[model samples]
Target: MAVQDLLRQRFFPHMWCPGCGHGTVLNSLLRAVLELGLSKNEIVMTSGIGCSARISGYVDFHSLHTLHGRALAFATGVKLSKPELTLLVPMGDGDALAIGGNHFIHAARRNIDITAIVMNNRIYGMTGGQFSPLSGIGVKATTAPYSTIDNNFDVVELATAAGATFVARSTTYHARECTELIKKAILHKGFSVVEILSQCPTHFGRKNREGDAGQMLENYKKITAKRGSKALEENPGLIGRGIFVEKEKPEYCQEYEKTIALAMKGAGR
Candidate 1:
């Protein structure tokens, strides 16, 4: 359960930039996995192309570093083939909500048994400061010199509407809460989503004038509140945190097995 034991020593000195929240999130994740008493062999991590996605490479576990925005697709396939292995998918803001939008919704709709952790840094940190679907309206990006006018996604709401059985939200500033929520999501039966608002000091931070990672995290603490808390009621702009939804549902792979059973019985083979 020690954190160091979960790391791939040869790949030490991660590639994340200084002040990047990705490192913090990764540590929180390892903590959660360790606390859950899960062995590295029992978990399979998958990721799409982005800074956050790089986490899949650092962990000493079965992992798939898939193409951009296709992590869920690969994760789903892996789950179907090997239902016993726990699927842990980590994706970036744009990687999860923009290019992977289709896969995101479909995965939720199917109610597949996989735990997806989205490290939402607002802007596309890995590929320049491009506006991501989770980036707030009026934010500046390389693609939007003046400001990005597109409406941002409320990830928790989106996941709930898409039919994920369990949904939770937390910020990198709230590392303890984030790790706990991740643990809960992983243990949930059906599709689960845990959104972590990470700070990208390299791209989003510079573009938004959020100062360094420390300053950005301080802002996050001031702007976010637990779901249904008095702070949210007092401050309309405060983002809501905590689990939004948790419900039991028949999982996709289980349903597929039933269908296969019926087919075999009908064929009398």
Candidate 2:
């Protein structure tokens, strides 16, 4: 079914304010799900606290609105229990990187059967504009009235090093591109993480001179264009907006099946 038809329109009123990048990410997610032709009943959207968490409420699917910074853990449980449904987590930067940082790493290391889409606005938008772990060093934020002193985490690099089977990054302005990346992640066999660089115009933008949603959108275009061009020169096969990681690996579920089979054989079940 098309995503528009599957949308829970009743929740539209709760959508983020105009020019909010979360909306773009949300649209991309829905498009990806629809393109996969997966039934809404078979997909579960899990989320943590922050503006991004509200996504779970709007999607027409089995949804779990988890506590702050623990969406991945919750997603892991849901995936393990069902093992058949698609588990997708939509989390904000601080929610996934700060409070839930440990769980994120372990989940990646285990190659859990789930996909996480972190909306990296680079700041905490839900509760004032606090600098997030992904915030560029010396970048001005509400909490960092002067400049962000902490070094930011390159989320894709971190996830790849932690053992995520699929790790990629995209920004909100690349709507079609972001959607394509998300679809690839969803179809991946093991743990996948798509770091979405979003913009919180209400907080991050208003605080800085990023104008508003419109301005931030333009910035995304510029950045993506420059990066894409450079990548092409470095690696001709590097599509501007395509899967960066795609390799066959031992999925966690497949290994678990082997474990159960061996245990049952040993016990003569």
Candidate 3:
């Protein structure tokens, strides 16, 4: 199907800012869904409260624009009820890592069959310019005018250590990479996460003096090193981008079905 078939154009004038990179991420996701040959009925999209979370309202699929930091919980329920459906949850830095952190880790640990995409724009773009959990140390925000002292959480690392079977990273600058990685994540059996380094030109750009959205994307190209690259080996501080983890695991829904069968047999019914 054409990619335009997946959109709800009535929401055309989106809520995101003029230069926000979430648009690229959304485009990649829609393209990936199309490439996967998933019909709108077969795909379930969920999101929480954030600029990125606004995607749920735009996608012409079974969507749930849920509460703050609760998209995973809602998505999990949906998956348990209809294990055959493809579940996708897209969230922002604060929505996924701050209030939704507990759910994020627990879902990873459960290894449920859901693809969660994180838009890491550093600062909170939706609710004014505050430093998000993914914001770098010393980054300036409305809350941290001088500089932020909070250490940023590494989303890829967190997912890997939480038992996610699939994890990948891409930047808004790398549109092809984002689509390819998300395509892989969707096909994975267990829980999968793809973190996209999105740019917030209004908030992050102005705060860090990173010029315009174009400049921020250029910086992404300059800073991102491929996994196991010689450049990363030499610098040791560069953000490595690639599929960091992919492993076979029993999906949560399938295991739960097995448990139900076992209980029924034990009851002699």
Model 1 reaches what TM-score against the true structure?
A: 0.97
Alpha-carbon shift of residue 44 in model 3 (angstroms): 0.6
Full candidate order by TM-score, most accurate first: 3, 1, 2
Comparing 2 and 3 by TM-score, which wins? 3
- For all candidates in order, the CA lDDT equals 0.93, 0.84, 0.94
Q: Residue 189's C-alpha lDDT in candidate 1?
A: 88
User: Model 2, clash count?
Assistant: 0
Cα displacement (angstroms), candidate 1, residue 68, comes to 0.7
Candidate 2 stretches greater than 4 Å from native: 226-242
User: Where's the lowest-lDDT run of ten residues in candidate 2?
Assistant: 235-244
Clashing residue pair totals per candidate (backbone < 3 A): 0, 0, 0
Write one digit per residue (lDDT tens) for candidate 2, span 180-250: 89998998899899988898888888888789788888887655542346756676643244455666678
lDDT of 1 by residue, 140-258 (tens): 99999999889999899999999999999999999999899999999998899999999998888898899999999999999899988999999988889999999999999999999
Instruction: Report the lDDT of model 3 for residue 45.
Output: 95
**How close is every model to the real structure, measured as TM-score?**
0.97, 0.92, 0.98
What is residue 213's positional error in candidate 3, in angstroms?
0.5
- Among all candidates shown, the one with the greatest lDDT: 3
Task: State residue 244's C-alpha deviation in candidate 1, in Å.
Answer: 0.1
